[model samples]
Target: MKRSYLLIALIILSACSDSADDSNREIDTVILNDLIQHSTEFEKKVYSFENGLHIAVGYGIANSIMVEGVDGNIIIDASDSVAEAEEVYSYFSTINSNPIKAIIYTHNHGDHTFGAAYYYNLEVEKPMVIAHESTSQYVERIMGILNPIISKRSTRMFGTDLPSEQVINVGIGPYLGVAQSPIGYIKPTLTFADELKINISGVEIELYHAPGETNDQLFVWLPNQKALMPGDNIYRTFPNLYTIRGTPHRDVKSWVKSLDQMRALKPEYLLPSHTKPLTGDAVMETLTIYRDAIQYVHDQTIRLMNEGYTADEISHLIELPTEVSNSPFVREFYGTIRWSVKSIFNGYLGWFDGNVSNLDPLPSEEYARRLVTLSGSEEKLFLALEEAVQEKDMQWALQLSDSLLALNYKIDSTNKLRQEAIQYIGGRSLNPNKRNYFLSSANELNRNYEAQPLLPQTSELLREISIDMFFEILSVRLNPKKAKGITQRVCFLFDSGETRTITMRNQIAEISSTNKNCDIQVKTSEQTLKESLAGVRNPVLSVASGEIDTGGQRTKFLSFLSNFTE
Candidate 1:
């Protein structure tokens, strides 16, 4: 039966249970049952194909594929952590046992690359690590300046802190396993810009850059086997055009073009990094519909944009044609049409939306105060929030609570109501991304909920990150108030024969390679500096131990570093 029809039946069944106890609120059984069914996509097993390709799915957030070569095997996209990779390799060992000759990263996502170290260090001779030329830099950005916020958002989206029963699946995978072990990322040894064709152990492999879900995404084509590996680009679930966790604007048009490039290959077998594989004519059929769906959304959004309709208006007006929506490939399992519409509008026209009101909107606090006054009084606003919850209008209740929180009235009562609204809406959501995010947000409202640190602190992972990224992180971490009216220049001389200077002026830190004049110069190895800055080592102790020399200006150097502390 079509999944959409099944969803309609589930929605009907959910209505019958609306009167279930609210005190013991749980995810709607109908939606929970559907998500439980979806978990089958990641069933733990080694699926071997006729072309000598084996994929280990449900072992981690990504599928790790192994292609049997003449004397050795090639691995495509490692699992999320050392623990998951080791487990996957154990399964691969039973099938081939041939030493892995190469590990190819489809993109820079941690789920695809973090567990690479296990595969790379398995044999006496390390396997060649290959990726797009820009992959390493993108990895650095994630592990560097964007680490804190991305990690926080990703944690919520994945429901990593939620109890196992509360998480059915993560849309694309069963669960993210990075927290199972330290990150196992190893830098790529061989990189390419557009395409790379190589022969490993008598098996010919061709990789092409196909940017879609991620800019560094690549698709693997094996002419000998007539098999294609399209990485995250063509997962079973809808593509995450704009992840709520936050991302740079994804180029929707380029995504369509990338799908077209894949269709041109006409492979007999399709092996995606998520979900199960497809063989025969189904491969072509799936590719065609997926690309068409993406193009349809892109074109329709642009058409309405030209009509002077705002993004909000376009989102409400646009709906996928029944033909496109019925395709199992385009379901709102991950990305929804509504979110995609706004992202596409923002990508091309930016946030203005051709509306003057939004261009210079009142501050959120001021707006909240006005809303409270319009409601007749703060008490009336609180009563309205209570009424919304009583009416089961959870969305409205959540919004009303926002104003109450903003006014700093009924702090404890407002939070309790807000939590109930989010939990209710989250429990009924069929989309896992929205479900997990809402539930995670609800959990945060608990009085005793404590957040765990999510940054990569292991030295092994730190070594894979570039030293220059540390300076980039420092520049963003500069405390404007502390740096105000401060003029100073600090120079770093790494033992690897590279020098960098940081100039602090006008409440900003500017980094330069050429060190003309320096007030204080510190000499150390890049590794030492990276470790010190990551808090793996105490800088004061390193300086005292003579590992980091500041030309006897230890106090000044320490003071200089303090300005960048948040």
Candidate 2:
């Protein structure tokens, strides 16, 4: 009777403690909204540059700049979101009643293009939307490719999940807002081939292809007026490299070259995509510093690669000198140099360290499970994990939990860990992208504990990725030495008889092959294919596991596969 009473008392105490904890956990909804609110609440400045030439800055969501050319008035890169765009329209109405002749989007990034719709949604017929040809090739494909990934990263960077907070700012100024992108965005209608010179209100705004932030970047240069628009390409901050919202690695070389191109333009005053509008010879100097800062990342990465430094080592070892890292223009607002350096290394050298020990690696979860076995007893392992968590070593805590959950069933320690880890990581404010993953993982683990669902398998995870992320996954499959000659040709075929072929040449994965009679046939609907490539699994994996005939054309197809360092 005594032992039973003791057990009952313990259960009651646990319940009481949980209730007390829940009561104290305030939502702070007001603060969350305020974070979203003040994030982009800054002064919008209107400056008259030259004769009838003027530009508007300080827009929430996306940067708004009005160019009063000779033809009429042209708006370049309308703000990203809806409410922000309308405010811009209101700002323009206050300035002048001049009809908008055209709206040119510098690139395909949602921010620069989406704002075009708001004015059209109003009484005005939508001004012709302009962009580079590459941007318009297939708007659906690009969105299908990047919408989830970029928005996810952007959401994390901007703290789109929660309301928003001062600590979670993604831009330098208080102007850039944070939030998830709505489902639909305005697609560019008109596009340029290479370069085009159009007179917007007699203001000669030369639209040239300067692929900086995105592949289809359009830079507007007022040659006669000595003014320029670099869009998101030449932000006042360090170029966002390896954004937390996931995408393929950006080419640091191309990025730097674009900045150099901007520097050569020698514009007196410039309105970039983010931060404040910069003017004077000081603008050029700032641009130069920004250019050299990116170059530092690229050059150091290559040098380390030549010396055969591993990606992890390169990420930790490479650092921008004080001249670059600490520069006002190089602050990590959108992206960090550390992640960028890692990206450069990952882009060139691939993931492997050329070591045989890491050649045939088990999946992360499976490896974690085995580790728990090696360490012995659940209680002892839990103690180590608690210590790591207490020390604020989130990295180690996460790694330890990986195997802990992998190893045991119905362990109280795992449940405690799930609850504690979530609280711990949820409190820390790191990079938006990293925070999301950490928090999401905590959520996932919590849900798993609440229900004790079976852990996911590596194969289950890989087969569900999309075309964009498949390259990253494929890179991981290669050994360092075999990675040298592994170029690949991926031809995506849709039932509509339309086909898109991607040729990944040079650098890592130097070999190539297509799905037409290649190794590893992936026969599925376009959506399924997309889901798989995006690193988000599709239902087809279940069918594959259940021995279902879901594997259509590519079920048993095999492509020539090899690894190479280009």
Compute each candidate's TM-score over C-alphas. Answer: 0.95, 0.68
User: What lDDT would each prediction earn against the true structure?
Assistant: 0.86, 0.58
Shift of residue 280 alpha carbon in model 2, Å: 0.1
lDDT of 1 by residue, 388-420 (tens): 988889999998998789889899999998988
Please write out the lDDT profile of model 2 over residues 293-313, one tens digit for every residue.
888888988888888777677
Model 2 RMSD, rounded to 1 decimal: 11.9
Off by over 4 Å in 1: 1-27
Go through the candidates in order and give the clash count of each: 0, 51
